[model samples]
Target: MTRVQANLLLLLAAAIWGGGFVAQSTAMKELSPFWFIGLRFAVATAAVLPFVLLERRKAAVKTSRRHLGLYLAIGLALFGGAATQQVGLQTTSVTNSSFITGLYVVFVPVIAVLFLRRPPHWIIWPGAVMAIAGIYLLSGGHLSALTVGDGLTVICAGFWAIQITLAGTTVKETGRPLALSATQFAITSLLALIVAAIFEPVSLDAIMGAAPEILYVGVFSSGVAFVLQIIGQRYTTPSQAAIFLSSEALFGSSLAALILGETIPPVGYIGCALMFSAMLVVEVVPELSRRRAQAV
Candidate 1:
């Protein structure tokens, strides 16, 4: 797919994840964070299993040990991010968690530069600022004093950055986005389940109570959205991908209002504008610059 199409897919993933915010919140009302995550990813693994088999039936790319390691590392990062975000949400306000987690848009480029020695295009820097500012505004411009949950959410953003960076690099090399998605989902499920078994109490009744949320998140959020992420990242830089995906906060707030009767402050419109501008800059500036350079 073209870069624009890929980025659009990433945007679609963000919208799905935004809707997941409600399911995640509601599920935890009856289930603990670890159990919720464990079950959610478990269902995701099952949801993706059929497509994985189908993909393998085609011209599948061989995975080397190094490639396998990359997939596993992304899974570890996914587990870390997922675990912390859910646990953190228990204490932090939704506004704080959403704003802080959206900071991954900023962290993505920083991680790329520091670890991979890959600096993003000049456009990404300002786009990051705009996206983040948009999220901050979307959160109603008030970040309460740091709580333990807020701290955990900070760590979650770092893990998200690492996962995005790794996924972008690995999928481009391996050309096996479906395999990467399945591997990461399975590994994340295994890790979350292990932790849940050790620390969280899981009752069948509680699981049943949260079944709808789990199934929705597992099938769409974890399975479909994450697969779109891997596939989309193959065509875009991690920094650019983050710019587009940062719209999750926007979509999340909008969905929360629509689905759960949550109220959004008036400033949300400004935040939405900024976020759209950010995505627009990232999408259009590079092409304009390239054309200008060619003309000169």
Candidate 2:
């Protein structure tokens, strides 16, 4: 695919992801967070089962035991991130959750620097500062009274960054993004189920009550959005994909306003602008540098 096509796919993936946040928030109303996660991932795993089987049959993509171990480890990271975010969402507003979760944009570079000894461009630090400010404003400009959910979500962002980095490293080695995704979903489903069994009262009525929301999340968010993400990222650089995916915050906030009657304060608009500016800086500066080099 051309760069333009790749960028477009990334944008489309972001939109799908943005809408998934809305589904998650809606699902929270009738379902316990763990229960919802368990069901969502269960359905997602089921949705991808056909593809997994077909790939195994057609490509003979059998994972060795050693590779399976790595896949499970990646799945654990994914599960940890999702579980923490869901717990945080229980106590936080959807708008806050969206904004806070986006901190991964900043965390990714930092974690890469720390864990992988990857040196980020000089622009990344300044962009991260702007992103932090944007997050501050997005969280209603109240820096003084941050809650447990805020802290949890921030930690969740770090885990998400790690997951993305691990995915980049491992997906290439495995050449099995689809199969890896399936494994991750299955692992997440099982983990969530165990958590729910321990802490949540699972009842037939509860399941029935959450049926619609569960189906939406499972089918659209976990299953479809994830597949799109894998496909879209295949054609784009991680940096480009990150900027395009940041559109999720904008889309999520707008959807919340339209569907849930959630209102963004004036400060939230400022936050949105700052975050967009930061993304532009991160994405555009490098492109301009490359163009300059080409001109020389």
Candidate 3:
């Protein structure tokens, strides 16, 4: 796929994830965070398993130990981010949670440069900062309402950055986005199910009560969107992927206002504008500079 196509996939993933924030928040009324995450990813695993097996059938290369290790690492990061965000949603507004989670845009570029030694275009740094400020505005200047959940979501952003970075590398290397998705989904499910079994009340009724949300997030958010992320990253840099994905904050807050009846302050509209501008700049600036230099 072309870079533009890949970025569009990432943008679609962000939109799906934006709605996921609403499902996650509402489901907690009937389910605990661990129970929700467990069952959700359990469904995601089942949803993607068939595709993964088919992918293996088509590709003759056997899975390597290194690939398994990388998949495990990505799964662990996914679990950490999901757990923290879910638990954080219990105490925070969905808008607040999403805004804080958008911090991963900054973290992704930073991690790429610091650890992976991959530097993004200079625009990424400023764009990331702009996105953060916009995300903060999306919270409608309500960050002062931050609870413990907000703190956890902040940590969740770091885990998301780790997952995004690792998934980018692993998919580029293995060219097995389906297999990666299934593995990470299964691992996350198993770990969450174990935790749910131990500490949380995992009842059939609770599962049934939150069934709609479980299915939505599992099927679309975890299964489809994550797969898109893996596939899309193969054709795009992690930093640019992050800029696109971070628009989830904008989408989430808008969804919250419409579905959850949450109010967005006037400043929140300004935040939306800023967020869009950041994405546009990140996507267009480098290409424009390259063209101008060619002309010169």
Q: Whose TM-score is greatest here?
A: 2
What overall lDDT goes with each candidate model?
0.81, 0.79, 0.85
Cα displacement (angstroms), candidate 2, residue 158, comes to 1.0
List candidate 2 stretches off by more than 4 Å: 1-9, 57-62, 233-241, 287-296
Candidate 2 has an lDDT of 0.79
Task: Kindly list the per-residue Cα lDDT of model 1 for residues 219-248, writing each as its tens digit.
Answer: 999788977987898898765786778788
Q: Model 3 scores what on Cα lDDT?
A: 0.85
Q: How high is the lDDT of residue 105 in model 2?
A: 68
Give the candidates in order of TM-score, highest first: 2, 3, 1
Report per-prediction Cα RMSD to one decimal: 3.9, 2.6, 3.6
Model 2, residue 256: C-alpha shift (Å): 0.7
Ranking of all predicted structures according to lDDT, beginning with the best and ending with the worst: 3, 1, 2
Error of 3 at 100 (Å): 3.2
Candidate 2 vs candidate 3: which has greater lDDT? 3
Clashing pairs in 2: none
- Regarding TM-score, does 2 or 3 come out ahead? 2
* Model 1 lDDT-worst window of ten: 137-146
TM-scores for every predicted model: 0.80, 0.88, 0.83
